[model samples]
Target: MKTKNRILQTALELFNEKGINEVTLRGIALNVGMSQGNLNYHFRTKSEIVSELYYNLVEEMDEAMKKITLDQPVFSLLYESSLVSMNILYKYKFIAQDLHSVLESNSELKVHYLALQKMRKQQFLFLFQNMIAEDLMRKEELKNEYERLYERMNILGDNWINSANLFFQERSSKVAHYHSLLFEVIFPYLTQKGKEQYLKSL
Candidate 1:
C-alpha cells in the first residue's frame, strides 16, 4: 500500500480502538511505523484525516446505493444495504461513537454532514415512494408518517452501532443483527404481501 493510504488505514484502526479525541497523530505515526515527519507529510492534523475518512465513507455508501434497482424488492435492497452500512460503520467506528464531537471539531466536516443528512432524507423519501408504488407498503398509512418513519430510521441507522455495542458485547459485531433491527422498524408498516415477500427474502 502507498504511504498515504497506509496512514489512513492505520489511523482508522487507532481511532476505532480509541475515540477521536483520545488518539493523536503521533500515536498513529508510531502505530504505522512511520516517522512523525513522514506522517505529517500526508496529514498535518488528525482532523484532516477524519474529514477525508468521512468523505470516503460517504463515497462508499453512495456507490452501494447506486447498485440498487427499482425492480428489486425493498427488503432485499434493505438487506444488502444494511450490510454495506454496517461495514462502513465498523470501518469508521469512532465517528459513530462520538459523531457530534467529531463533526464539531471540524467546520468543513460539519457542513458536509449537514449536506449528507439532506441527501439521506431525499433518498429515504424516494425509497418509500418506490415501495408504495410497488404495493410493498401502504401509501395511505405512510402518507401521514413519512417524516416520523424517516426519523426512526435515521436514529437506528446512525446510532445502531453505539447502541449495539452497549447492549450486545458479542453480537454487535454481526452486521446481520444490526440490519435485522433496522429492517424491523419498517416491517410493521408493510402490506401482508409485502410481509410475505420480506420473510421469503430471509
Candidate 2:
C-alpha cells in the first residue's frame, strides 16, 4: 500500500483500538513503523489525518447510498440501507464512538457534518412523502412526527456503538443487533400493507 493509505489504515486501527484522544500522531507513527517526521510529511497533525478519515468515511457511505433506489419496498429498502450503514460504521467504529468529542474539537468537521446531516434529514423527508403517497406509511398524525422519528434514528445510529460496546458480549452480532433496532424506529408508522410487505421481507 502507498504510505498515505497505510497511515490512514494504521491510524484508524489505532483510533478504534485506543480512543482517538488517547492516540497521538507519534503513536501512529510508531505503529506504522515510520519516524515521526516521516509521518508528519504525510500528515501534519492528528486532526488532519482525522479530517481525511472522516471524509473517507463519508465518501464510502455516499457510494453505498448510490446503490439503493426507491424501486424496492419501503421496509426492505430501509432494512438494507440500515445494514449497509451499520457495516460502514462498524469499520470505522471509532468515529461513531467518539462523535461528540471529535466534532466538538474540529470546527470545520462540525460544519461539514451538520450540513451532511441536513441533507440526510431532507432525504428522509422525501422518503416519507413517497411512502405516504404509496400508502405504505401512514400520514403523520401530528406535525413533524416523522421529523422527530428521524431525529430519534439519528441519535440511535450515532450512539449505538457505545451501547453495544458496553452491553453486548458477542461482538460479532453487535452490528446486526443495532441495525435492527435502528430500522425498527419506523415500524409503528407503517400501514397494514406496509407491515405485511415488511413481514414478507423477513
Candidate 3:
C-alpha cells in the first residue's frame, strides 16, 4: 500500500484495538515506521482520520447493499444486509465509537447523521412497500408494521453495536449473542414460509 494508505490502515487497526482517545499520531507513525510529521502531512488531525474512516465505512455499506438485487427475497436481503453491517461494526468498532462521540459533541454532525439515518429508514420502507406490492410479504397489514419494526430495529442495532464495543473493551466473550436476538425479533414479521426458511437457514 501507499505510505499514506498504510498509515490510515494502521491507525484504524490501533483505534479498534484501543479507543480513539488512547490512540496518538506518534503511535500510528511508529506502527507505520514513518515520522509523525509524515503522518500529519497525510492527516492533519485524528478527527480527519476518523472522518475518512467513517466515509469509507459508509461507502462499503452502500456497496454491499447495492449488490443485493431487488429480485432476491426480502427476508434474505435483510438478513444478508444485517450480516454485512455487523461485519463492519466488528472490523471498525473504533470508527463507530468516534462517530457516536462526534455526533454527541457536535450538533451539526448530529443533524447530518440523523438526516442520513432518516434517508436509510425511508429506503427500507420503500423496499418494504415494493415487497408488499409484489405479494411477497405475508399480509398487507405488515406494511404499517414494517415501518414501526424498522425504526425499532435500528434502535436495537445501535444499542447492540455500542454494547459490543463496551464488552470488547472489557475483554468479555467474543461471541455476538445479540445477532441471534435481532434475528428472532425480526423473524416474526417475515412471511410465514419465509420466516420458517430464514430461521432454518440460520
Candidate 4:
C-alpha cells in the first residue's frame, strides 16, 4: 500500500482498538513508523483523515447501491446492498465509533453528515416507493410511517458497529450476522409476497 493509504489504515486500526476519542495523531504516527510532522504532511488534522474516510464511505455506498438494479426484487437488492454497506462501514469502523463527537467538534463535518442524512432519507423513501410500485410492499398510506422508518434505518446504520464492538468479542459477526439484523428492522413492512420472496432469496 502507499504511505498515505497505510497511514489511513493504521489509523483506522488504532481508532478501532483504542477508540476514536482515545487515540491521538502522534500515536497513529508512531504506529505507522513516521514522525508526527510526516503524518501532518499527509493529514493536517485527525479530522481531515476522518473527513476523507467519511467521503470515501459515502462514495463506496453510492457505488454499491448503483449496482443493485431497481427492477429486481426490492428485498433482494436491498439485502445485498445492505451487506455491502455494512462491510464498508466495518472497514471504517472508527467513524461510526465516534461519529457524534467528531461531528460535534467539526461544524463542516456536521453539515456534511446532516446533508448525508437528508440524502439517505430521500433514498430510502424512493426505494420504499419502488417497492410499493412493484407490489413488494403493502400499498397503504404510510407517509408518516415511512419517515419514521427512515429514521430507524439511519439510527441502526450509523450505530451498529458501536453496538457490536461494545457487546461482542468476535468480529466475525460483522461479515456473517449483524447486517442481516438490520434487514429485520424493515422486513416487517413488506407485503406477504415480499416477505416470502425475501426469505426465499436469503
How many clashes in each candidate? 0, 0, 0, 0
User: What lDDT does model 2 reach?
Assistant: 0.91
Which candidate, 1 or 2, has the higher lDDT? 2
> 68-94 in candidate 1: lDDT tens per residue?
664666787778777777877777878
Model 4 TM-score on a 0 to 1 scale: 0.89
After TM-score superposition, the amount by which residue 75's alpha carbon in candidate 2 deviates from its true location, in angstroms, is 1.9
What candidate 2 gets wrong by more than 4 Å, as runs, is none
lDDT of 4 at 124: 83
TM-score-better candidate, 2 vs 3: 2
Rank by TM-score, highest first. 2, 1, 4, 3
Q: Model 3 over residues 48-110: C-alpha lDDT tens digits?
A: 777777777778878887887757656666677777777776677775656678677656557
Can you give the lDDT of residue 123 in candidate 3?
90
Estimate the TM-score for candidate 2: 0.96
Q: What is candidate 4's CA lDDT for residue 5?
A: 91
Worst 10 residues of 4 by lDDT: 134-143
RMSD of 1: 2.0
TM per candidate comes to: 0.90, 0.96, 0.79, 0.89
Instruction: Look at candidate 3 and give me any clashing residue pairs.
Output: none
